[model samples]
Target: MIQTHRKKAGFQHAGLLLMLLPGVVFVFIFSYIPLYGILLAFKNYNYSMGIWGSPWAGLEHFRTFLTNPDFFRLMRNTLLLNIYSLLFYFPMPIVLAILLYEVRGRFFKRFVQTVSYVPHFLSTVAIVTLMGVLLSPESGIVNLILKSTGAEPIYFMAKPEWFRTLYIGSTIWQNAGFSAIIYLAALSSIDTEQYDAAYIDGASRLQRIRYISLPGIGPTIIIMLLLRLGDLLELGFEKAFLMQNPLTYDTSDVVSTYVYRVGLMGGEFSYATAVGIFNMVLSLILIGIFNQISRKASSVSLW
Candidate 1:
């Protein structure tokens, strides 16, 4: 009987593994198989020779990238943009989730949520074009309003100072609603009894949110934060590329954009790969550091 039970459990576990097989195979094919291309980072990457046949360059590409004059500027722009995203864009979702959770009218809440989610579905080109139309110096409503007030028409897209602001703002507008869905799911998992008990004790709404809702979703928040840290340097290449112009390059040129121009356009495959590898390594280190810190401080981490 004991042997029969063990065999049954083993079959159940095997079934679960079988169900997971497709995803494992998919990831292996798409993600792990491509890892061999990392060789490009350390190779001269002659087009005629291909990746494996190319001669090893022995850190030549890495050294060149590090010594490049735009190195500091690229690093600065990427880090600052990501930092701004972490500060501003990250919290917007949480705030929206909290607000949505507080709303009593189900119809109104659903309507608002649907409206907020519309921006996320828009293509990068559409979003950038919309921005252009809204901020155009001549016909844009923003410029027209400024003109009406006897103020100068500001060319927002052409200004370096406005690039980061516009990028971050658009990111929040596009993603916050969709990102909030995770927090809402987390909030829903909290025991409703705690909320009821707080209400019975005459606790205010803010106090309940502070003591109950916040604590309930703390683990989810920490996990999401750790995951976000893993992609600290992985900005969306499409949006940045579309939104930027020569005048805004100082603030808008990120590592990814630079990699595209150098690797794909300029045909410097090895050097671009080296730069990308550096970005990936830095991101890994950051996530590892934050994971440890979060584990120690909050007993929550991705690992």
Candidate 2:
């Protein structure tokens, strides 16, 4: 009987592994196989010689990036943009999830969720184009409204001061609802009997949320936060690149955009690769530090 049980367990495990096979193969192809390109960071990459045959530059590229006049500005913009997102945008999904969970009407809740998620599916280029049209100084609806109100038209996209605000605001609008899905799933897993017990004890809706819903999704929140931290330096290049103009580079320039300009446009492959490696190292260190803190404080971590 024991042998039969072991065989059954083995079959079940085999089935589970089979189900996971595609994802494993996909990561191996797309993620692990591309890791060899990191060698370009240490090499003086030559198009003719290729990555493997390129002359080794040791720490030359890293030193050049570190000593560049714009290094501080690049770091400042990247850090501030991500920090603002963490403070303002990170809580939006959690708040949305809790509010959605509290909605008793199924249809209305579904409608709201669908509407909120629509923006996430929109392409970044499309979103940036929409922003440009809406905020155009000459003929935009926004400027027309401002003119009617006796206010001057502001060139939002070109203004350095407005870059971070627009980026973070658009990010929240695009992603909050979709991100909330995880929290909603976590909330759904909480025992319904606990909620019933709280209600029977005369707990208010807010009280129930505070005591039950929040706690139920707390681990998911921590895990998501850690993941976000892991990508702290890894901002989306497309939207930032699309939204920014030369005038806004003071505030809009980030590591990713800089890499694109240097590597792709200027053909400084080795220098760009070094800068990217630095960004990756910082992100790994950040996630490691936060993971440790989370584990010590809440006994939850990514590791």
Residue 131 Cα positional deviation in candidate 2, in Å, after optimal superposition: 0.6
The candidate scoring highest on TM-score is 1
RMSD of candidate 2 to the true fold? 2.2
Candidate 1 on 1-303: residue-level lDDT in tens?
Answer: 999999999998998899999999999999999999899999999988888899999899999999999999998998899889999999898889999999999999999999999999999899999999999999999999999999999999999999999999999999899999999999999999999999999999999999999899999899988988888888889999999999999999999999999999999989999999999999999999999999999889888
| Candidate 2 lDDT tens digits, 107-161 | 9999999999999999999999999999999999999999999999999989999
Question: lDDT of model 2 at residue 1?
Answer: 100
User: Worst ten-residue run, lDDT, model 2?
Assistant: 228-237
Instruction: Count backbone clashes in candidate 2.
Output: 0
Model 2 regions lying over 4 Å from their true place: 1-22
**lDDT of candidates 1 onward, in order:** 0.94, 0.94
